[model samples]
Target: MDHEDSARFAFLHAAPVIGGAALLKLPPLLGALGDGLRGPLLAGSVAAFVAAYLAPRYLARHFEHRALIPFSIYCSVVGLGSLAYFAVT
Candidate 1:
């Protein structure tokens, strides 16, 4: 996609998370936490948010794109493993 299209896509993807943080999480977190801990909590959450947002972009940029086979295999393995474990139990 072009630059504007990419920006729009990112914004569209991010708006819900950002809006939820502002409207849902932030108010409750601020109210529940004290002044001493709020700064650290907010900073850590921002760091986590940034990492989660950028990690996929970094992986996509640096790695050869393999669509979804690896993920599907992983899910199948986990699902079968869980089924086996439950069956045994």
Candidate 2:
């Protein structure tokens, strides 16, 4: 397929990985944390990935030449931010 299609495909693929990991071993996590927090925690983390992946795709759809640069920047910043946030707290 095309570049946009491929990007979207990859973006969709990331979702399951995010959610699955969230659910996996999450029973004990929620057990310790409580029911109220579990849904939001998994949801928020998955949402973060979706937002990070989408920002670049949106910019690239019309921007053409400048697309990849901003996309890369967005991904790096978002990915790194997620990493740091997850690592610290």
Candidate 3:
């Protein structure tokens, strides 16, 4: 049941995930546009979105269960850095 729930809920949750990602990324995108770097910034955003979407498929095929380790490390580093910064401030 848990596995079934996860399977069913995973894709269903992607909309909010993508929306939240876009929201979080929008400020830098807007700033880039203001700085007249619109074309490169937009291209980079598209490339990033494509890579994020496709990389999982490749990772699932090659790394299977360990596919998320790198991403987890990245998130952990960012999260800890944010926590430390806030604590120091």
lDDT of 3 by residue, 5-62 (tens): 4434564477588789889977876774557767777898799778767755554455
Worst 10 residues of 1 by lDDT: 59-68
- Candidate 1 residue lDDT tens string, 3-85: 34454477569868877766876666677555577888789879977986776576555344445468779999999999999
By lDDT rank, best first, the candidates go 2, 1, 3
lDDT-better candidate, 1 vs 3: 1
Task: Give candidate 1 regions above 4 Å deviation.
Answer: 1-18, 62-67, 80-89
Q: Spell out the clash pairs found in candidate 1.
A: none
Q: Flag regions of model 3 displaced more than 4 Å.
A: 1-18, 24-28, 31-35, 64-89
Candidate 2, backbone clash total: 0
User: Please, what are the lDDT tens digits per residue for candidate 2 over residues 1-89?
Assistant: 65666666777787788678868867767796676787787887689878876765784575554446677899999999999999999
List clashing residue pairs in candidate 2. none
* TM-scores for every candidate against the unseen true structure: 0.51, 0.45, 0.42
Task: For each candidate in the order shown, give its overall lDDT on alpha carbons.
Answer: 0.71, 0.75, 0.70
Alpha-carbon lDDT of model 1: 0.71
